[model samples]
Target: KYVPIENAKYTLTERFVDEEGNEISPSVVKGTDYEEGSEYDVTGDAKVIDGYYLKETSNTTGKFGKGDMTATFTYAKLGKIIPVDPEGNPIPDAPTPQYPNNPTDPGKTTPDQPVPEIPGYRPEVPSVTPTDPGKDTPVKYVPIENAKYTLTERFVDEEGNEISPSVVKGTDYEEGSEYDVTGDAKVIDGYYLKETSNTTGKFGKGDMTATFTYAKLGKIIPVDPEGNPIPDAPTPQYPNDPTDPGKTTPDQPVPEIPGYRPEVPSVTPTDPGKDTPVKYVPIENAKYTLTE
Candidate 1:
């Protein structure tokens, strides 16, 4: 609940902390009351500290009744007063929003144009490696190799109203199955363990929650602009190219190093918790110990 202060003004002052815990001072603004005890949901640009604005929900609360929120501002002994309005979203009137004019071209007053779609959603194969003639574009995107992820566990719904462990595997989603993700159930995996809910109970039998096992499935090779996979892509059978002209070779046999991992030619997880990953194991009478 909020109690508005008309005729009188409210303001709060505080120092700012940098991401590294350093304190910044000198430039500052104050916040006033929209009213006390009033619940409000929020949107708009994230609050900024040290030139960075906070985006997204830092927290959430209900809106006070049904009226739209407002803003009002007074200049500190340092500057000018800013008027009020819902600047694209609902924020209170007391804590006026201040935007520092773009300093790179502060003298020129025109605005920047907009490019509606991002590269991922653009038409054509967005350059695998940037070839931008303009200074604004990056030169190229470094391709990270041997990057791999494994499946782990699943968290699903409970049967009806009971709380028991009976969940399905995330492999279900890998093969393109319709599953739940909201409230009623969850689908957890190793590489990306999640415990979300699906209100409609789309995972499985009404109420069943359980721990899931994990395994390596496969890797993704970055495809080239000419419909071919990039030569250095981490796909099976494409390793050790001395010439560098890129070859589409056949799958190489697992090397004779008895217990070395011959399963995946691509990179595998190096950390499985507190222990360092063992790269190879020595075979002995069919049993082996991974090199410690």
Candidate 2:
């Protein structure tokens, strides 16, 4: 008599995934049908993958039972170490080190990464610790206490034109350090310091500038055609307000002289360090009139 035999079907599905259950590599599947009482071993780890390592496994070694079985292998992708500022922005030109793909122990930190040196800034942490795969480790950097800055001194006239040479001093002081540019202002001839802008302040992240605005202090002198001072010519006084752009002096009326008529009725000074001429010509005698 022929005996009826029962058979068992089992499926071994090997999956490579990350901690977040995302597959890093393709799945390997195999299936077989065996006798109900047959013993089978079909689950194991997968091959090495670039930039990924075995993290955990399920059903590494299991017997083929009446029901289907599925096995899986999870992996962890190496993480990257990034340098950043205090605001969490990535630092420019900074090195980004990656964690070892096959660490001796999973979920543990890898070797410390070297922190790059940044000019005028200090790293908050000397080194970086690379942790869990697929995550970034940030190294913060802050401004150094002794960082130097530049200060520019400018002496300009009311029209914003430089009256004196500009002084540029770089890498002189640290941030927030107080500085005084009052003494640096020059004593320019025919001009006086009217006001100042950003002349005195504490240094900051950007370059500092000190502008000393000056106004012209000029006078008017009257002279003759021979380039000699006019005898008894009234001196025109400059206006008291130096901020005036015209820099005009009060008009001076011609003085009365015997047997002379002044060339001009009045004289007005227009330019600084310049002379305005006023001539006195001899008057001609008028012929006597005979008519009644």
Candidate 3:
């Protein structure tokens, strides 16, 4: 018969699926039909006829999720109903022994989630205390593009020049939009970088910052004692020869790091002379002396 959400009654099946694609035959669920709707929701263990009513629903029927553990009850009417609880009980231990319905999906347990042991493992989680502000945490960031590796490639370019992708520490570290790494760069340990002063960074991080500037690193292109071209070193763009087009190094004329200075006020006699405070200073270059 058709039933409403409240004051509802429905039947369920007894046979179910076991994990590993096996079939499971469950004992039938036996219960009297309770009306569906809001009155059914008396949460927690309440004494029903035989088992505990574990839910707040009026209807005697329940639904199940896939791969979840469920309890099957053989209704006294020779029918079945699924309950949220895994332990199937025909009669409530206590009247209205209630918990919510369908705690988990049936037959959907994965290989990893074995049937939980009676004494389950429960770890204690520490509570966060707002009053404890005395702790400190360290931070470090490493980028993937900065790492270097040896690769086999063709020795000649389309113009019969060489195509090399050699990188150096500090020297070729690309300055991307996200990080501000303006440093007096120095090459160190293979392909990594650190600031000349307080600079901080990871080795082999960031992109090939100066793929265009590789020719500037003179020592990379090796030669025999007689200065013959190394078999793979392409005829450098600078060609290490003063006569070559690269009369300058890639990082050359590196424009000085920009500086910032607060704007001078009009200094009118009627204005708040020497009393106004600057809201902000964009560039903090403390090296240069101010005349005002």
The candidate that wins on lDDT is: 2
Distance (Å) between predicted and true CA of 215, model 2?
Answer: 57
Better of 1 and 3 by TM-score: 1
In candidate 3, stretches whose alpha carbon ends up further than 4 angstroms from where it belongs are: 1-6, 12-17, 37-292
Query: Over the stretch 130-212, how does candidate 3's per-residue lDDT look in tens digits?
Result: 11111211111222333332211222222434344433433433333232233323232111221122123332322223222
Task: Please provide TM-scores, in order, for all candidate models, with all chains considered together.
Answer: 0.16, 0.36, 0.13
- Model 2, 214-284: lDDT tens digits are 88665444555465666665655444424443244456565555555667887666554345566766567
lDDT of each: 0.29, 0.66, 0.25
- Over the stretch 136-230, how does candidate 1's per-residue lDDT look in tens digits? 22211222232222222343222233223543443322212244333333222222212233322232211222332222222333333344444
RMSD of each: 24.5, 22.6, 26.9
Off by over 4 Å in 2: 1-11, 18-23, 29-48, 53-56, 59-62, 86-89, 92-95, 103-109, 116-126, 143-292
Model 2, residue 253: C-alpha shift (Å): 82
Worst 10 residues of 1 by lDDT: 72-81
